[model samples]
Target chain A: MAVHQRQTVPQAADRLMPSGAAHHEQVVARQRRGRIWAIVFQAAMLAGIVALCALLLNILNQSFGYVAIVNTIDPAELAVDGVPLNELPKENLVEILEANISAGLMRRYEHDIPFAERSRENVHDLILERVVEPQVQATWGLFDSIFARDSVFAEADERFPGSDVYFRSWLTTSFISKSQSSEPLRAGVRTAIFGSLWVVAITILFSFPIGVGAAIYLEEYAHKERLLNRLIQTNINNLAGVPSIIYGMLGLAIFVRILELFTSGAFLGIGDQSTANGRTIISAGLTLGLLILPLIIINGQEAIRAVPNSLRQAGFGLGATHWQVIWHHVLPSAMPGVLTGTILAVSRAIGETAPLVVVGASTFIALDPSGPFSKFTVLPIQIYQWTSRPQDEFRNLAAAAILVLLILLLSLNASAVLLRNRFDRSRAIA
Target chain B: MSRSAPIAQAAISAESMQGPVAGAESTSESVLGGGPPLDLSRKPRVAESLIQGFLFLCGAISILTTLGIVYVLGRESLLFFANEEVNLLKFFGGTEWQPAIGRFGIWPLVTATFMASLIAMAVALPMGLCIAIYLSEYAPQRTRSVLKPILEVLAGIPTVVYGYFALTFMTPLLRGIFGRDIVEIYNTASAGIVIGILVIPLVSSMSEDALSAVPNALRQASYGLGATRLETAVRIVLPAALSGVAAAFIVAISRAIGETMIVAIAAGAGPNFTFSPFRAAETMTGHIVRISGGDLSYDSIDYNSIFAIGLLLFLLTLSLNVLSQWIVRRFREEYE
Candidate 1:
C-alpha cells in the first residue's frame, strides 16, 4: 500500500514539474549557442595570428635569406674589377642565381648582378679576353652549370676573371668597412647608421626636455577647465597627427631658408650649397623632434595622471610643498611610464624615413657623418638608393640593410618591454 | 569619598593652572584664536587663481601652434597669389602643373592624390574590416593574443621598407599577375596597394575596439531570438558599433592621405595629373617634396608653394580629425 502511494506522489510531482522542465531546456539551448559563438570568435583570432606570423616569416625569409647568400661573395674578386663596385665579377653570378631560385627570391634579387669591366689595351683586346675567358662560369666546377639558372646558385663564380683563383663571399671585410656607393653591390650603410644614430640622439635631446617640461606644467601646475588649458590640450592632440612631411616643409621654409644661419656650400657643405642651405643633421633632428613632441606630451600626461590622488594628499598631509610632493612622490611613480613612452618615440624616430627624406636626408653620401651639422643619410634612404639601381648587387645590400633595421627595431621594442616589466615588478614590491 | 577626591583634584589642578594663566597674561593674550577661521578658509581661492594663470600659459603654447598654422600658411599663400598673374578660380580649375613652363595650376596633382588615397581606402576598408571581424569574433583567445601584436608590428615597420617592397616585390608581382606590365616601377598601383597594407592596422585596431564595446548581452538576446552568430554580429553588434567604426575608418583615411614615403619612393617623381592608377602620380605632399628638392630661396614662389600645399593638406586632415572626435563623442556610451 505504501509503495503504491509513493508511485502516485511521483506522478503528481511529474505533472507539477512541466513548466520548470521547459525552462531548463531553454537555458541549456542558450548556453550551447554561447559556447559555439565563443569557439567561432576564438577561431577567427587564431587565423589572424597565423596570418601575421606568415607575413613576418615571409619578410624574414626574403630579407635574411638574401643576407645569407650575399655574405658568400668573395670581396677580393669584387675589388679587382674596381672604380664602380657594380663591376665585381661574382655579383653577376649572384644575380643569375637570384633569378632562378624560388620565384619570390628570384624576383627580389634579380637587380643585384655585377658587371664586368672593358679590357684596357685595345678594342680587340677586350673581345679577345671575353672570347678566351667565356666571361661567366660556375663556382663549383662546370658540373654546377646545369643548375646555373637556379636563383640560389646563380651568384656563384667558378674563378676570379683573368685569374684561376676560386672566388667566394661577395660580402667582404670591406663591404661593411666601405662607405656609400652608387653601385648597390659596393654600398655600405656605415654612414647611414651613424647618421641615424646622430639624428635620433639629437632628436631625443631636443624633444624630451621640452615635452616633459610642458607635460609637467600642464598636468601638475596648470589649473583645469581654463581656456588656455583647453587650447593646449587641443593643439597637442592635433599636432600629434599632423602629417610629418608638412613638418618637413616647415623645416625647409623656416630653418633652411628663413634663418639661413648655415648655408649649403659644396665641399664645405652638402652636395649643392646654394640649394640645400640648412639641410644639416640639426635641422632634420629638430623637425623630427617637433613632429613627435605631442606624442611625448600626451604620453607624459597620461603617466602623470596615473599617479594616485591619495599619494598627493598624503604628501600634503606631511607638510610637503606642492612641488615637493610632485618631485618626491609623483615623478618617481611616473618615471617608468615616461621612460617607456620615450623608448617608443625613439623607435618611431629611428624607423621614420618619410619626413626625414622630405627634409632631404641625402640618398647617396659616401662618408660617415662626423658631427650634428653634417649632411647625412639613414638606413631607409640608403636602402632606397640601393634598390633603385639597375644593377642586382645593390638589391642584396638593401636586403641586408633591411634585416639590420628590423633587428634594431625589434631589439629596441624588446628592451622597452623588458624595462616596463622590470619596473612593474619593482613597483609591486615597493 | 568620590566628591572629596574630585574636590581635592580640582584644587590641585587650579593651583597648577594659575601660574600658566598668569604667564600667558604677561605675554599678551592671543586675539580671535590666531585671527578669524574664515580668513584661513579663503586661502584656496588664491591658490586656484594662481593655478588658473598657469593653465592659461600652458594653453597659450597650443594656441601658438594653431595660430602659427594660419599665419604661416596664410602669409605664404597670399604671397603666392600676389606674385601670380592668375587668380584662385583659374588655379583650381587649370589643367597644367608644369611649374618650369610657368603654369601654376594644381588641379591635376590634387586629383591624382585623391585618386590614390581613395583607392587605398577602398582596399584598406574591406580588408581591415574583415580582419577586425576575425579578431573580434572568430579568433581564439590564444590566437588573438599572438596575432594582435604581429599586426601592430606590421604597422610599425618603417614606411621606407614598404616603399622598397612595393618597388621591387609588389611591382614585379603585379606585372606577373596582370600578364602585362600594368604597373610601372613607379606607378600608383604599387604604392596605393602598399599604403592599403600600411593602413590595415589602423583600421583593424580601431574597429576592434569599437566592436568590443558592443554589449555581450545584446548578442545573447539576438541568439536567444534564433539568430546565428553571424546574424547577431551583423544585425545587432555591427549596427551598434557602426558610428565608432566609421570614425575609425576616417582616421585611417586621414593617415593614408598623409602618407609620404611610400608615395615618394614607390610612386614616381612625376607630377602627371592623370587619373590612371597605372601611371606615376604626385600628391600634395609629394609636390611639396618635389618643389622643396630644388635650389629655391625661402621667399621664392617655389618655396612658398610648399606651404600653400601644406596648409590645404593640414586643413583637410584637421577637419577629418575633428569629425572623428565628433563621431566618438556622439556615439560613445558611458558603461560602468
Candidate 2:
C-alpha cells in the first residue's frame, strides 16, 4: 500500500505540473477561442432576433403600400351635363349600373339592398363598383413608396400613365368590415374572421371540460400502478406529440364522411342544405379541439399535481368525502393554472392551419359563416390562399390578414403567459 | 406527515380526543354516530360512482383518438392499395406521382420531404444550439425575460403567416441572391428555410431547458479547474445534457417534416424526385393539402392516394416521437 501511494503521488504531481510557458500559452489560446465562440453564440441569438424582426418588417412592408388604380370606363364619361359620377342622381346612377353590368348581377345587387331604399351615394358607389371597375395596375412596397417616391411615380408614369396612385393601408377598418372580393382592390377579411371566431369558439367549448376532467382523473383518482392509468398516461403523451395534419385526416374521415349527417346538422333538421354535407364549422372546430385536447390534459395534470396535498387533507379532516374534498380544495387552487393551460391551448388552435387545410376549409369563401353548420374559411386559410395567387396585390391583402392573425394570437399568448406568472406569484405568497 | 390517513386511522385518532367520561367502546360508538352506527361497508351513491366513471372516460378519449386515426388510416390505405392503379410494389419502388398518368410511386414525394427536412435541420440545429447555450449559460435576467417572450411570440405566429413569408419575402430574396434562373419562385429552399425559422423557437426553448437542468456544481467544478465558461458549457454541461438535447433535435426534425402550409404554398405543386434544394418539389404534407384542398372527387385515386400518404406520414412521425420519448427515458441523467 505504501509503494502504491508513493507512486500515485509522483504521477499526480507530474500531471498537475506541466511545462510553464507551454501550459500558459495553451491556456491563453483556449481563452481566446472561448471569447470568440461566446461572441459567435451571442451572434446566433441575435440572428434569431434579427429573423423575427425581419419577418415582422416584411409583413409590415407589404401591408401598407401604394397602388396604381386604372378605371376601365372613366366616371367622367358617365357624367351628365358636366356633373361628376358621385354627383349624379340616384336613379341615374342605378340606371347606369343596370345598363353596364349583367342582368343577374344587377338583380343580385338590388336584392342585397333594394334600389329604391339605397341612398344616392350608395347607388353611385355601386355604379363605380360594378362598372367603372378601378383595377389596380401596379403595386409598390411601402419602403419604395416612402424612400423612392420619385422612382415610384416615374415607374407608374412609364407603365400606367392614366392610373392614379393612392397610398393605401390594407389593414383599415373597412378592410375588417368588408367581405372578400375577387378584385384585390376590394378584398377584406370579414368573412374569414367570422369563420375563425366560430371555429375557435367551438374548439374551446368542446375541449375545456373534457380536458379538465381528464386531468382530474389522472392526477386525483388514478393510482400510479394501475395498468389502465399507465396506458392512458402514455397514450396522452404520444397523442400530444402527433403531427396536427394527421388529426385533419381523422376529422375528414370521421366528422366529414362517417358522421356527415350529424356534423352537417341534418340530423338536427337545421342543416345548411347548400353545403349538403359535412365540411362545416363544427367539423373544423371538433378537429382542432381534438388536436389541442392532449395539450390541455397534460397542462392540467401538472397544475393539479402542483396543488399541496395538505389542502386536500384539510378538506378530508372535516369528514369531507373524496369528491367533496377535491371539489372544495383541489379544484379551486388549480383553476387558475387550468385556465392558463386552456388559454394557451386556445391560442395554439387559433393559429393552427395545416389541419384545417386537410379538413377542407374553403379557400375562396365569400360568405360569412352564420352557424356551426355553415361552410367556413378561416383567417389562416385566407392568407394561405391569397399568398398562392399570382397577383402581387393579393399578396398585400395576405400581409394585412397576417397582421390581424398575429394580433389575435399574440394577445392570447400574452394573456395566458401573464396569467401563468400571476398564478405562480399567488402560489408563492400562499 | 400523513397527508390523508385512511378513514380507520382517522377514527382511531378521533378516539384520543374523547373525554374521560367515555370508554373506548362508547368512544367508538360516538364516532360512528350511534343513531346509524356509521356503516363500515360504505356504498357509493349512483351519482358519485357515475361522476368518477365519467372522469375516467374523459381521460380515455385519447385512446379513442389514436384508435380512430389508426382505423381510418389503415382502412383507407387498404382500399387505396387495393385500387388497380396503385400497385403495392410500385408504390414503394417507382419515383413518379402523377395520378393522371396512373403513376403513384411515393419516392418523389418522399425524396422531396427528405430534402426539405434536411435543409431545415441544417438551419435549425446549429442556430438552435447556439441560442440555447447563450441563453442558458450567459444571458442576464433582463435579456432572458425579453428574449424568451419574443421567442414565444415568434413561435405563436401562425404557420400560414410563415408560408406567406416564404412565398413573398424569402423566395424573392433567394431569387435575387441566386439569380432568377437558378432559383424558382416556388422552390424548396425557401420553404425549408422558413420552416427552419418557424421551429427555431421550439428547438431553442427545449434545448435551453435541458441545458439549464444540468447541475451548477458541474460548472463550478470545471471553473475550479480553470476552464472558461464556453469550455464548461460545451465540454461539461452539454455532454451531461446530451440526451435531452438529442430529444429536442428529434422533435424539431419531426416538426419540420410535418410542416404543411409553408411547403404547400411555396415548395411548388408538382412532385419531382430531385436532390437539389434550389428546384421546385412537392413534399408529402404539401401533396396531401393540395389534393384535399381542391374539389377532389370522392373515392378517386387522388382522394385515396392522400390517405396512403397520410398513413405513411403518421407512421414516420409516430416512430420519431416514440424514439425521442425512448431516448429521454433510457438515457436521461438524473441530477441531484
Tens-place lDDT digits, model 2, residues B210-308: 999999999999888767888899999999999999999999999998999899999999999988899999999999999898897778878888999
After the best TM-score superposition of candidate 1, give how far the Cα of residue A9 lies from its true spot, in angstroms.
24
Query: What is the C-alpha lDDT profile of model 1 across A275-386, one tens digit per residue?
Result: 4556778878887787777888889899888887767665654434455666799888998888888888888888887677667777667767877767878877777666
Task: State the lDDT of candidate 1 residue by residue for B1-336, as single tens digits.
Answer: 123322222222222211111111112233223443232222344554464455445445555656765777778888877775546876787878766666778887787778778888887887788778778766779877878888878877888787777776677777788745566667788788878888888898999999988888888888776565666776788888888899989898888888887787777886887888888888887777656654456677676667777888888888888889888888776555
Model-by-model lDDT, in order?
A: 0.67, 0.87
Candidate 2: segments with Cα more than 4 A from true spot: A1-16, A76-108, B1-27, B32-36
Candidate 2 RMSD to the correct structure: 5.3
Which candidate number maximizes DockQ?
2
Candidate 1 segments exceeding 4 Å error: A1-177, A262-276, B1-62, B294-297
> lDDT (0-100) at residue B325 of candidate 1?
83
Name every residue pair that clashes in candidate 2.
none
Please state the error at residue A133 of candidate 1 in Å: 17
Query: In order of the candidates, what TM-score does chain B achieve?
Result: 0.82, 0.91
